[model samples]
Target: MSKLEAGIVDGASAGYGAVACTEATKNPVAVANALLEQGPHVMLVGRFADEANKNFGFEVVTNDHFTTPYRKAYWDQTAAALGQRDSGSEMGTVGAIVLDEHGNLAAGASTGGPTGKVDGRIGDTAVLGAGLSADSKLAVLCSGAGDQIFKHLVAANVAKYHVTGSSIRDAARKALQSISATGASCAMAVIDAEGNAAIESTAKLFSVSWAPASGPSTTGLLPTSFPILPTHTIHQCLRNRITVDRALWGGALCSCHGRRRCLSILPLHGLSKEWHPVTSKEKEFHEEYPGYISSNDGPMMAAEKLDGISSRIRAVSGLTAPFNNRFNGPDEDSKLFARIIRGELGQWRIWEDDHHVAFLTPFANTPGFTVLVPRKHLPSDIFAIKGEEFSALMESAHSVGNLLRQALGTSRCGMIFEGFEIDHAHVKLIPIHRHSEATGTTVTVAPFNHHYQGSVTSLNGPLLKGTASLTLDAAELRKKIPVKTITSPRSWADPPRHLSAVLQEPWYKSLFTIQDALFHDSIAFFQKQLGYKYRAAVIQAVAGTTAHLKSLLELHRSSGGKFPRVTVDDALKLVVMNSNDWRYVVESDTSKGRTLTRDGELKLIQHFGGAVWVTEMDHLSVPFYQAFIDDTQAKARCGDLLLGNGEVLGAGERHVEVKDMLAALEQHQVPAQGYPWYTEIREHKPLLTTGWGMGIERFVAWVFQHNDIRNMTIIPRMKGISFAP
Candidate 1:
């Protein structure tokens, strides 16, 4: 497994810095893709930093594109706009994207903390396994403080917890609680491909701001309980278009978390459903792509501009990141200056007003999908542009939107302007299926929860599967039907029979008989073994059955009036109050058929070795339960020998200590390969783990030649998947 690699970005003043890790490879681009693709698999801690470039705004580019000075300048400029002074030399953000080329997991991270931060201070972003950790199976991220992260070992601990099967949210909660114990504020997000995730924060003041891979946005201190996605009533505006920015999704913009700044934009429902898994075709061609920036949105500031005057560079280049805001003014001469360099002064029928420019990429083949960029480098926003610029921006957006509808075969289109918020104005025109088309002909109804039995009858007719043959279980059919309940044992013993019974009664199916019979026997066996064991035993009469009569009489003694003061009812009520101890009694006196079903066999083995009355027997073991009764005839012949003497027995058989014959058998040995071979290897493979075992009831029922296990009990069972008979 590859280890984690990390880096730090010191803040403007030095206090706020971001830490990052690129896993398993040195390729920063691969690292970037992996981070976006599989994160927040890596733990993030202490104000994790993420940045997008204005140059690569609408286009999809590899991480290699980020290495250019222009891109770096863009990053620096955006940071400066966020209240940091730019050295105009290099970028401070730290990151790398790499694939698993060497078969080892690797990661790296770096960051410059909060802007205008105090000098010499560091956040959790730079530390390995603090903000990020990478192994073959786990990756994590922390988005809070290094101090809090360290206090709880949030990254590593959350990563480890995730490996153990805790859900991501659960692990996040634990991580947060761990930090909270030390009175530290923490927020984190973890994604483990292992189906575990945890998003949490220690700041009671903390709020969860998350954009789900699917479903709606969430913000606030999430409840530890409930599915990761919460259900709520939604409106149209919040369902059409949205920003890709995670912070914007749930952070300051969420009214749910009491963040009053939640912007009410159209929900990106179409994008959430369709634009996912951006295919090569989708990326290469824009077809009503609702998420990407569109024409009329302004151009991005590629990089931070320097004051140095390079005549040659200035000849071919436009203003850079630090260009004066006046670049967007109605200055025609200034607009013409840019137009002259591009060699398209009115020749290509260009429209310029020192504010915006429109251009179609050489590769752009789709109709109505053009890029709009402002002459000045600034964050793009639908609400920010003014005067002619605003009107021009809208006109451009409308033109493109109409073109998209005509070309993409859609009625209306979605407009999304998400990127370059820190610096540069941009917008996207995305066409989508009309609301009616998307909704389909039928409305979707939620599943019925109350009084729902997972049967077709519980649902509306339209939702039901079949039409010709109404299921007898359907609500309408059942309402007109009469249900017969057997209150007395006699009624159950001799159920009323009729010819129409096959169609009207539920018991017409032979499958029901087999199921009910087996279940009934199993339930009895469970109660006999696990319930008041001293109270009863299932009576069976057999000619060769040793102690058969004696065992019956012994059980009858307990059933008689001279029973112990504290009865089985008391024992059952004390342990399992819901238990019906009376049901454990098996009165098979005149019975011709007695047998145990598969469920009986299973229940016998499970309950016999695990009862309050039997649990204390250390020697008792389940493995032996099958072996002892596996050969009941042999066991019966050497009863006392199997019973005990000086030889101690396993837990379940502890009450029966061996003395003579059994003690002698303890040391006997015979050929290992012989058919009837026998041996007493207690000392070598000591009977330290022995027990009173075997589904004796099942064994008897099986050997007794009964067709069903229910014959062995009083009232047979009628529910559950598997039954005794």
Candidate 2:
């Protein structure tokens, strides 16, 4: 074994980034055993830093409890790290090679074999030169089937390619292509003596481009003198013309080969004979793309423009960490307009003026979703982009809107300002397939809220309970609504199911399981989750719950239902909840944000009608009830973990009232010392959960913030002042 890890910490910023380790007891074996336990034999054990909070904790590497029947616990690994497929390709190694500042070269790997193989199973992990190798000249690390890798000495082959003067990226790519031609899946990450690095994976390809102040601009996937590129930052204009050397898609068009969709490349900066990763004015931004997932919409790409730039919403749909007003900090890096005007992240640049530029946005309900922004001025958002600059942008938007009918084969395109993700003042061109789909911010309700059941009415009208939650038992609930699994198109930006209903079209497919889960396994699951005495015996049965939760949440968020994401702590709890708890309602608003506090949970409750709860446990542990409580709609309840000794732990205040647990709780006050997870409504009674809800239209309306989307609800209005216009 390559030295057991002293500790695994994701020190990405500190330069001691995530270290991927593979495992190997010995050689390869094709003695395929029965499906005894072929679960994803992947374990992610590490201390990940919470960057926003500046805290660190050992993230529970959701122990992949099982490999068969596709358990839910398997999802946290995908959410946190590069998600691995669980089926036939379960035999992959985790390895890396390094070339340091002083020219030190070192390589290491750990391997996991196919389901049930012999101990002497030699493959890449056991043999250094197969999965990885490093010498004075170069270092190479790889991940893939060990059998194919060992036989070809894939690592040594890449080194030989490097010795023969092939660029490190090309050398790795060449070796990978050669072996992959034989149909054994493989990918490579490489580094040469000068400390330059490159990576190739079956999942997707990402280009990390940087322009150092003194030396030539560098991109791992690109050559200094333009090379035949497969995937580059897409910057092509909307004119549909395809060429092998340089073609663009997803800014405007897309093509699929087999199951893989090669979503790559932007029109080489300005179509010059030589391709530059960045333009002259982009010297200010330091860029980093730490890999991305390939998807139907496009490669779910991620780009980090650092040194003080406004962070952007990563390509992960519904993930809006980058959508902030962290712009214009009087620093060169903060100048996003300077980079945008210089063609810095542009794709499908159809038209431009002295003051504005129009480009394609990835988040689209229709194919040709585009955006119009000011080029000459740097305004924070729509309110700031005023006077001549705003007028110029509006005029450009009008011109672009006029062309949408012909370009997208739609009757018309509507423009709306959505500042949820991008703080920059830009207008989105929604290609309205239906004339009346666009309805602006209007709140509609289901007319049944316990809070609003009998409330004081304003001069405008009575407070309408647009949505409500009835605490019904499983029997009672099943009688009312049809319960089935719905599979949405794999894009988070696709119109949500509710919105599709608003349009009277079912674009998504609903998957229905003819039966429910096996109750014995389910019983053991809740036992393990609640930490009963027999919990230890149900390890295998309960271990895979996380993957199920991860998948469910991903599907929900991707399908346009509000699924608030969290670290493995609450997420794993949710995995258990999916199996054990009969039905769970993710306490989220129509928009986004979940808080689990009596203190901070007031926002969602006040906005509509809800309640908050906290079941404080040890900060180091995940309590069963805390799972239900932490499922709230606030970013952070911001509490503290404390001991009876009265030492303040993480984030809270302990009153004399908290000493009397039942008394305080009966009055429905609270309890706490930790902040791992929390939620609102009914007390955390064992085996029972009461919840709240609102109209789906109101929630999705919040998600797709647009005014033109009018809904002709079978029933339009009721109590209170419902949106009419």
| Best-fitting candidate, scored by TM-score | 2
In model 1, where is the ten-residue run with the lowest total lDDT?
Answer: 637-646
lDDT per residue as tens, model 2, 685-716 = 22332232233333222222212113313223
Give the whole-model CA lDDT for all candidates, comma-separated. 0.36, 0.37
TM-score of each: 0.22, 0.25
The residue-level lDDT of candidate 2 at 624 comes to: 23
RMSD of 1: 26.4
Deviation (Å) of 209 in candidate 1 = 22
Q: Cα lDDT of model 2 overall?
A: 0.37
TM-score of 1: 0.22
Indicate which candidate wins on lDDT.
2
